[model samples]
Target: MQGGLEFKTEIELLSRVHHKNLVSLMGFCFEKGEQILVYEYVSNGSLKDSLSGKSGIRLDWMRRLRVALGAASGLAYLHEFANPPIIHRDIKSNNILLDESLNAKVSDFGLSKPIVDSEGSYVITQVKGTMGYMDPEYYMTHKLTEKSDVYSFGVLMLELLTARKPIEHGKYIVREVQETMDQTKDLYNLHEFLDPAIGLGTTLKGLQKFVDLAMWCVKESGSDRPMMVEVVKEIENIMELVGVNLDANSTSISASYEETSKGNSPYPGYPYS
Candidate 1:
């Protein structure tokens, strides 16, 4: 899978996908038994870095919501807008890249598979994806569906809110969050699990709704999970409910992150990493 046909598969899949929220493939090199893919530079770095506080980019509540919306939009495009529908077998926080403007772009399509000639039909294939992010149903049934991606994205959504890996300390984020969450209290009584950087002291508007939608996406049954398109719509509604003006916040956030990152950025400033 390293230097052979997986490279070609990635190229084919990436070439067919074009979206602002998706990492764009510029070109590739295949010569002298070498394989190289050149992608557009995303200055900010991976979402994992930021969530782990390695990027020095402090994402507030609105910023996190925007990131969720952007990533969901990209997945929706792949699932619903692409020429042939695509199921991104891997949808982890490590594969989500952030730009200087804090926009989210889905990356690493090496495991992506196209669903051909049928609507809402699944492919019987080997289940391939990161542990804890893989859909439980797909893992048992070996039937790859677009909803499988939804299950993984739901885990990523939880990671965004909690700043924890899908699996940490022998625990899964989905179950941990579900058990800890109490809708009767503020912030769903998830103070211990929610990341402090997302402004828990202050109000997080539409957070309960966001958490509900994310939990829906992570439902045990694929049939019970909402589609990526529905995820995008609900995220948009959350942003609207919070009154996050997309155009205005981009500039302000850049400035704030710049000051925070001044002479102390944890990222190496790699142009193509």
Candidate 2:
């Protein structure tokens, strides 16, 4: 009965969401008590495959930045534009699909939930998410919020930058990065942690900003994390600084930054006085 409820929830939520950066559901199947979701085939496979060398294609630094931005845009759309803002309870590289052109499309809506009340900041519910990507606050309090996704996405950013799994040999990547940042505080030393495949020759300033944003996202308290709209703008700024041109689609997205910024709280329900 619980499985049926979850499947119905996914179908109901995903059927209403339409975005360039989100995977589209073409159809589904429920035969012989077996359930199957049919999503548009993403030829390039998952982001996890691309980063882990499972996929033969090597992603350059520019392409990786584009992937990060594209994924951020998709999350921003979910948190801000969806009718009843959806929360992607599970966000990880494995769930991020890549098209033939390397455009990112967030997949796997099985754990997604909708925030039915616009005024409510969060929903109290049983926790459900991957180990490394789960938000600490949500894990502890069982109060799920949009910021929970921000924390997971922060882990995703660390994965993109370091090309390391969230957990390895009993060490969490977040702790490793934090300790390194604390010890060195120097960009030169930080390079040692970066994924050598795409990190070579990348601008240090841009990398620093990216790392900073990721750190902010993973802050202990959800109140400290930037909203998804802020995240989208920050990534755009980073890309522009690194000399990447904003495409027609991204240009339109940039325009919304200001309008969305007006009176929006960094922490939901805690507007600026």
Candidate 3:
């Protein structure tokens, strides 16, 4: 009964909003003391399935960028448009859904909460979110912010570029991701750590830019990370540098002018506070 009530509440809370990247709540049902929220079942399942290498579906660089853009839009909407603002509280790959066309949708709101912008210090409370993706600061001090999700998103980007689990290899890969841009820090020797599944076919500059952004997002201090909107723009820029032509919809190296889709707006909110 309690679980049903929780689902009902989450359904009611998330149903009213409509955005390109959020999973739409179609309806809800109560039966036999169980509450169920019906949603548009995404065909590609969770991003975790792709990240874990168990889905047998290979996500190319272009598709990956789209996924990132979609997710950021979802997070931005919750933080900016929702009345009083909603903090996802738990942002991880398992909560991200991919549709039949491979579009991304952010889901899971049972732990979401609303709070007004405040001049007070960030909240320090019980840490919530997946172990590998949880912000270290939140884990230690319980202070939470939208940036907490940015930290996790950084992990997700590294997962996309390197095809490694966030917590795998006993924190070795995570360390490399955190220190990729710092010359003094050494972890896995990133050049040697690319996921074998990807076969080193990605463009060098493209891949490096992705790595740099990933490292920036996972900075030890939450204030140092950029917002998801900025992250999306960074990825688009990297895509252009790599010859992907995000606006052209072609993976070919040829410089083409055919427009694919409108590019995302640069992050408008405060990335640091």
Candidate 4:
């Protein structure tokens, strides 16, 4: 999969997709038998880095809300707004990229597939996605649907709030998060259970609300998961509660992410990391 020609096809496919929350393909290089995709170079790196103690920066409550909202916006667009719905079969923390301003962007479309119509859901013959992030229903039935992405998205949200890796050594960290939740640990002390790297100031109520929503997304039954539109509304509500104003017209997702990202400041002077 790593070759100049493969990279060419990838760029060609990605050029058709234009979304504020998606990592833009700035250009590509096919030189000396080396293929490289030149992306917009997000300064903040992947959500994995921030959640795994790699990034020195600590995301505060407001920024964390923005990151979650931004990622939801990206997935919502891929699921509903694209001309043909695109399923990010590999929706994981590593696939979620960030910008200089910490804006979330969906990356790595190698496993992406386009769904032309409702009937397409019934036709998928292969089950593909990350281990723990993969939709349980899809993982068992080999069916591909937008809801599958929702399921993976739920796992990503868990990583955000709990600051834990989605899967480690073939065991989903959800088991840990659920255990902590059952133990009645204070949500604000998520740093205790979460990746110690991301500074902790998140509210328990807010974190619990998102955890509930994330659980819905990763439901064992696909039909039970909410639609992308509903997901957008709920994420917006969460953001609003945290004081991020959202524009109504931007509900299309593409417009809304752009609307939110405009004039936003990067985490102040974190050495451009």
* Error at 185, model 3, angstroms: 14
Number of the top lDDT candidate:
2
lDDT of 1 by residue, 1-273 (tens): 376767988899998789889999999999997799999999999999999999999989988998898888788778877767899899998999999889999999988988884655688888789997888778877889999999899898889899998888888788778778899988898888899999988979999998999899978778889878778767877887898765654323323323432112123431111
TM-score, every prediction:
0.88, 0.90, 0.78, 0.79
Q: Indicate the TM-score of model 1.
A: 0.88
Give the CA lDDT, 0 to 100, for residue 96 in model 2.
95
Preferred candidate (lDDT higher): 3 or 4 = 4
> What is the C-alpha local distance difference test score of candidate 1?
0.83
Off by over 4 Å in 4: 2-9, 29-34, 117-122, 169-171, 178-205, 247-273
Question: Rank order by lDDT, top first?
Answer: 2, 1, 4, 3
TM-score of candidate 4 relative to the true fold? 0.79
**Residue 155, model 1, lDDT:** 90
Give residue 119's error in model 2 in angstroms.
4.0
Against the true structure, whose TM-score is highest? 2
Cα error, candidate 1, residue 192 (Å):
0.4
TM-score rank order = 2, 1, 4, 3
